[model samples]
Target: IDPRKTETAEIASAHHFIVPGSDAYLLLAMLQLMFERDWVNAGHLAPLLQGVETVRELVAPFTLALAQERTGISAAVIEAMTEKLVQTPRAVFYGRMGVSVQEYGALCQWAIQLINLLAGNVDVVGGALVPNSAAGYVKPGERGAGHFNRFQSRVSGLPEFGGELPATVMAEEMLTPGEGQIRAMLTLAGNPVLSAPSGQQLDQAFEGLDFMVSMDIYINETTRHADYILPPTSALEHDHYDFAFHRLAVRNTARYNEPVFEPEAGALHDWEILNQLSQKLGDHKGIDVKMFPAPSAIVDQSLQQGPYGKHNQRGDDALDLAALREHPHGIDLGPLTPSLPQRLCNEEKNIRLVWQGIADDIERLRIASPPQQQGKLLLIGRRHVRSNNSWMHNSHRLVKGKPRWRCLMNSKDMHEHKLADGDDIVISSRAGEVQTEVEQSDDVMPGVVCLPHGWG
Candidate 1:
C-alpha cells in the first residue's frame, strides 16, 4: 500500500491507498484482530517466542475501527485483509519506506515480524526463510551479532545503532556546544545535506565545521562545502563483490566481479586513499594502514570460513573466492531453507515477541488521535529511475529525460486549491517551503502530494 498509485501497485493483484504515516496503526490493528480471533500461530517457533500475551494486551486499544480512522483505509477492508492473512497459506507481510520513516518506524518493523510469526510462517518452507548467506552468515550465539544501545550520540543522547549515530542527528551533533562536539567530518559516497532529515539544518551545520573532507566523485550538494575533495576510482575501475546486498537477496547466491576497465595512471582507489590518510594520521589516530588487507583478501577469507567454504567438510562442493570467480555471472547457492534457531543471533536462540519500548510506543498511538488531515496535505516523496541519484545529474545520458522534479498534486486537490497543471506553486510545511511547478495526477490520494527526492 502507498499514497501514490505506484507502478508496483498498478501490477499488484490488490492495492490499498494508505495514509503516508499511519501504517503502524494498521499493523497494530491487524495484530489485535489476530489475537482476538485466536489466529495466533507460530507453529514450531512457539517455544522460542516470548510476550505474545503482553503484545495482545498492548494492541487491544488499536482496534480495526481505530486503524481505519487513522489510516484512511476502511474498517471492513482492514478486517477482510486481517482475515485473509489468517486464511492464506504461508502469508508474509512486508513493508518498506512507508513502514519506516514514520513516527513509529521501529514499532512498525517489530509488528511486521510479529505478523509473520503469528501466521505460523517463520523459518518454514513457502514462508520467510532465513538463508545462510555466503557473504554474511553469522553463527548463532555470536557475540555482538545484533547488539544495540551500547552507546549514544554525545550531543542529543540519541541511541547508536552498530556504533553509528543516526544521520538525522548529525546536524545537531555538530551544532550543539560543549563536550564531544564535532569539529571535523570525513564524508564518503553520501549526500546527507540533500537526503537526510532536517537537511536544510545540515547546510548550516556543515559550514561551521573546522575541517571537512569528502571522498566522492562529485561535488554535489553535500560535498560542495568540503575543504578537500578526494576523487577515487569509479565502480567501472574497481573490482567488486556484492558483499553487502547479497545477504538481503531472497535466495542465497554468491557473485564476484573483476573491473572491466583499468584505472588511469595517477588515479587512486578509495581504499588506497584511506590507507594513505591513516598512515599520515599516525598509529594512535588512525587504523594500521601498512597492515590493511585489501577488500579481495577480506572476501576471500570470508568465503574460506563460510558454510560452503574450503573449511567445510563438504569436499569438492565447497565454495571459495576462486570458485565464485569461476562463474562470471553468479553461483546459485540454492533456495532459502529453514535455518531458524541457528539463524538467530542471540544466545537465547529465541524470538522475543515483546520489547518494552514498543509496548510504550503502542500506548502513545492508542491515546493519541491521528493528525487532522483537513487543510493540510500529507507530503510524500517519490523517485524516478533517471534522476534518483543526485550524482547522476552530470550524466547527460541518464538525466536527459522529461523533467522529473515537479510537485504532483491529486486532481481533486488541484481543483480545490484553484490550481492547474504546470502552475508554479509553493509547497509549505512547518519546517519550510519549496517552490516547484505543480502537475495534476488523479493517481495520488486526494489529500496526498508528492515530490521527487533528489538534489534538494
Candidate 2:
C-alpha cells in the first residue's frame, strides 16, 4: 500500500493513503496484530529466529487504535492487511523510498525484515529469497568486534560504516576548519549536488572546494564545478558484466555484453582511468598494472574461477565461461531455491535476530512522533520513466512532447488555496524553497505535494 495513487497502486488489491512518515507505526501495529492473533509461523521461526519476545513487548504500546490515529489508516484496514500477511503461505513486505526517507527509517526497515522472518518468508521460494552468485565474496566480519570504528566525523561525530563516513557530511567536512579537513574531492559517477539532501548547501560546498575532480559521462550540474572533468567511455563502448546486480537479482541469471561500438580516439574506460591514476600516484604494491589490464581479461578470470567456471576443480557441476560467450543473448540459471540459515548464518551457524543496535533503537521508536506539518503540505519526490536523473533532462527524446517537471498538488488543496492549474507556486521547507508551476491532480494525497527529484 502507498500514500499516492501511483501507477503501481492502481493495480494493487488495495491502496492505503497513509500519513507521511508514519510507516513505522503502521508496520509495528501490523506486527502487534500478528502476535495478538497468534498467526505467526512458529515452527519455522522457532529454530532460526531470536528476540521474538523482545519485539513483541516493544510493539505492545502501538495498539491498533493508536496506529489508526497516527497513520491515518483505519483500524479495520490495518487489521485486514495484517490478516492477509499472516494468512498467506509466503509473503514479503517490500518498501522503497516512502519508508526510507522518513523519520525512523532504519527502524521501519528492520521491522519489515523482522515481519518477513517471523512469517517464515525469508530465504524461501515465493518469499524474500537470497541470491546465490557464482562469486563467493567474503562476508565482512561482525561490527563492533571484528570491524570496529576507527574514527568519527569531525563535525557531526557520526561513526563510520565500512571505513566510510556518510555522504551527508561531505559539505561540512569541506567547509569546516581544523585538522583533516577535506579540501579536495574525487567523485565518480555521483551527482551529489542534485541527489544530496540540500542542493543549495552542496552547491556552496562545491564552490568552496580547493580542487575537485569528477569522472562522469556528462558535464551536468555536479561536474560543471570540477576543476578537471574526466569523461569516461560510453556504456556502448565498454565491455559490461553484471557484478552487483547479479547478487540482487530475483532469479538466477548470467549475461555478458561486448562493446557495441569502439570508443572515440583517446577515450579511456572508467577502470583504465582509475588504474592509470593509481599508477601515477605511485601505489602499485598488490595490483598488477600490466596483467589483466582490460575489463575483458578481468571478466574472463572472474568467470573462470567463479561458481559456473569449467576450470573449477572443486565440483563436476561447474559451468564454462566459453559456453556463456557463445550464448550472446543470456543464460538463465533458474528460479530461487531454498538456501536457509545454513548458507547465510554466522560462523557458528546462528542467526542473531536481536542486535544491540536494534534493541537501543526500539526505545527511540517507542517515543517517536511524526513531524508537525503546521498547515503546510508535506513535500515528497517522484520519478518518471523517461528521466533517469537530472542528466537525462538534456536528452531531447526524453524531455520532448510535454514538460514533466511540475509540483503535483491535490485538487482539494489547490482549490482551498485558490490556485489554478499551471499557476506558479512557491514551496518552502526548512532546507530551502523553490517556485514551480502547479499541476492539480488527485493522484497525490491531500496535504501532501509531489515533486520529481533530480531537477535543477
Candidate 3:
C-alpha cells in the first residue's frame, strides 16, 4: 500500500491508499490480528527470537476499527492483506524512505521485521533473507552497552550512535558557541545545502567555518562555500567493485571492472587524496601507504582472501582474482538459500526483538494522533529515474525533454485554489519558501502535495 498512485502502485495486484505518516498504526493492527488468530509460527521462532510477548502486548490496542480511523484504509482491506500474508508461503514487506522519514519511523521498521519473522519468512526462499557476499566481510563484534552513550553532542546532548553523530545536528554543532563547537568542516561527495532539513541554516553555518574543504567533482551548492575544492577522477577512470552493495544483493555474485579510460594528467583518485591528507596529519602508522601503490592491488587482495577464494579447500570450484579477471563478465554464486540462526551475529546469536530504543518509541506511537488536515497540505519528496539529485542535472542526455521539477498537486486542491497546470505557485514551510511551477494530477491523495528533491 502507498499514499501515491506511483508507477509501482499502478501494476500492483491491490492498492490501498493510506493516510500520510500512519504506517505504524496499520502495521500494529496487522500484528494484533496475527496474535489474536494464532497465525504466527511459534515453534520455528521460539528458540531464535525474543520479546514476542512484549510486542503482542504493545499492539493490543490497535484494533481494526482504530487502525481504519487513523490510516483511512478500510477494515476489510486490512483483514484481507493480513490473511494473504499469513497464508502465502513466501511474502516480504519492504518499507523504504517513505516509512523512515516520519515521526514513528523506528517503530514502523521494527514492525515490518517482526511481521516477516512471525510469518516464518526470514531466511527462506523468496522471503526476507540475509544477503551473503563472496568477499567474506564478517559483521563486526558487539560492544558493551556503555559504549553507545559514551559521548554526547556538545550542543544538543544527543548521544552518538556507533561513534558518529547524526548529520541533522551538524549545523547546530557548528553554529552554537562552546568549547567543543565545530570550527573546521570537511565534506566528501555530499551536497548538504540542498539535502539537509534546513538548507539556509546549513548554508549559513558553512560560511562561518574556520576552515572548509570539499572533495567533489562539481562546485555545486554546498561545495561553493568551501575554502578548497578538490576534484577527483571520474567514474570511468577508476577500477570498480561493489563492496557494500554485494552484501545487500538478492544473490551471491562477484565482478571486477578495470578502468575503461585513463584519468586526466593531474587528477587524483579519491583514496589517493585521502592518503595524502592522512600523511600530512602524521597518523599513517598501520595504513602502509606504499604497500598497494594502485587501487587494483587492493581489489586483488580482497578477492584472494574472500570466502570463495582459491585458498578454500573446494578444489577447482574455488575462485580467485585471476579467474574473475579472465571471465570479465561476472561469476554468479547462485540464488539465496536458508542461512538463518547461524547467520545471526549477535553476542547471544539470537534476535533481540525488543530493543529499548524501539520500545520507548512505541510509547510515543501509542499516544500519537494523526495531524489534523485542514487548509494545510502535507508535502513529501519524490524522485525520478532520470535524476540522481542535483549532480545529474548538468547532463543534457538525462535532462533533455521537458522540465520535471514542479509542485505536484491533487486536481481537487488545484480546482479549489483556481490554479491551472503549469501555473507558478508559492510553497511555504517553517524553514523557507520557494516559487515553482504546479501540475495538477490525481496521482497523489487529496490534502497532500509532492515536490522533487535535490532541486536548486
How would you encode candidate 2's per-residue C-alpha lDDT over 75-163 as one tens digit per residue? 99999888888678777789877898776787889889878877777876778887766543223342343343478999999878668
Estimate the lDDT of model 3.
0.82
Better of 1 and 3 by TM-score: 1
The sequence of per-residue lDDT tens digits that candidate 3 reaches over residues 1-456 is: 777888888998888878889999999999999999999883365688878898888888889998999899999999999989988887888888889888788788889988888888787887887765776445435234334666888887888877887777888989999898899998998899987778888999999999999999888788999999999988888888888888788888888887899998988999899878877665546543442256666666666666676654657877766778887888888887777676666668788888788777777888876677778888878886777656676578988888788878999999999999999988888888878899987888888888888774
lDDT of 1 by residue, 107-173 (tens): 9998988899988977888777776678666776445655467898886778877777788789988
Give the range where candidate 2 is weakest over 10 consecutive residues by summed lDDT.
137-146
- Give me the displacement of residue 46 in model 2, in angstroms: 2.6
Candidate 3 lDDT at 89 equals 82
Off by over 4 Å in 2: 42-45, 136-150, 283-293, 311-317
lDDT accuracy of residue 399 in candidate 2: 87
What would the TM-scores of all predictions be? 0.95, 0.92, 0.93
Candidate with maximal lDDT: 1
Q: Which one is best on TM-score?
A: 1
- Candidate 1 accuracy as lDDT: 0.84
